[model samples]
Target: MTPSSSSEKSFNDWYEDEHIPLLSGVPGWLDSGRYRLTISTTSHAPSYVALHRWTDLAAFDTAEYKTATNTAWRTTVMEKVVKKERFLLQYKGELCNILDTLL
Candidate 1:
């Protein structure tokens, strides 16, 4: 999701306040963390990347993923303000250093 810095940080902070300790309570989900990537000033607009990592495939397939979701404000914001979508696909080969964890 593309979010302005202020909105992005606000959403993340709100989510952390709402989730955090709660996410660890959700079964099958472990080591959940949020990460932000630096923006490229050369681009037309400043941007940031948000990363959410689940323990493993099973963690993602489990009930936690279904029952635990975005906070109300975030949900409303996405529903009202954000109007873009992308489908994620799992493929061979590492997309980035994310695999470094396993290595």
Candidate 2:
């Protein structure tokens, strides 16, 4: 997500204080983290990214999830976002563990 320069602070505050906490309460939501882009190969890359892990896709369809996403603060913050992207990825299998081999 790329928030407008004018709304950067508001976006950070709302996302960290409100959004993450709310989503964390939803069942099957395992963990979440937010990161700022320090380096990127493409200029079009967003300034920020958030990753969320869930036990299953069904967690997203729950009433709690909807309530967390549909909020006044979210609406306000989103208006300031110039670019955003979302993806739901499924875990396949771990390819290799270097640490295991080393041990």
Candidate 3:
């Protein structure tokens, strides 16, 4: 997530304080986290990343989650951001080992 400098404060506040909490109540949403990249070769690369965990794809099929995300505030935040990326991923085997190797 790379928010415009002007909207950075608003984006962070809405995402951390409101948006994430709202999404948590949706069915099959396991958890979520936000992070910033410590190292990057390109200065224009995304500075932040948000990881949202779900039980399965069925989680995203729910109307509740869809409705929650399709709000005015969400739209406003998205429009203000410069760049962002979303990934839907599943947990494979032995993530702890992979993390150890990478770190």
User: Which candidate ranks first by lDDT, i.e. highest?
Assistant: 2
Better of 1 and 3 by TM-score: 3
- Per-model TM values vs. the true structure: 0.49, 0.88, 0.81
- Look at candidate 1 and give me any clashing residue pairs: none
lDDT for model 3, on a 0 to 1 scale? 0.84
Q: Record all residue pairs in model 3 with backbone atoms less than 3 Å apart, i.e. clashing.
A: none
Q: Kindly give the stretch of ten consecutive residues in candidate 1 with the minimal lDDT sum.
A: 44-53
Candidate 1: how many backbone clashes?
A: 0
Please report how far candidate 3 places residue 36 from its true position, in Å: 1.7
The reply for model 1, stretches above 4 Å from the true place, is 4-6, 41-46, 80-103
What would the C-alpha RMSD of candidate 3 be, to one decimal place?
4.1
Report the number of the highest-TM-score candidate: 2
Model 2 TM-score, 2 decimals:
0.88
Predicted candidate 1 versus true structure: per-residue lDDT over 1-103, tens digit per residue: 4455446566566557655655666765546445444656565432433344554556556665545565576575455323243444444565667678788
Q: lDDT per residue, candidate 2, 1-103, as tens digits?
A: 9999999999999998999999999999999988999998998999999999998889989999999999999999999999989887998766578988899
Off by over 4 Å in 2: 93-103
Q: What CA RMSD would you report for each candidate?
A: 5.7, 2.0, 4.1
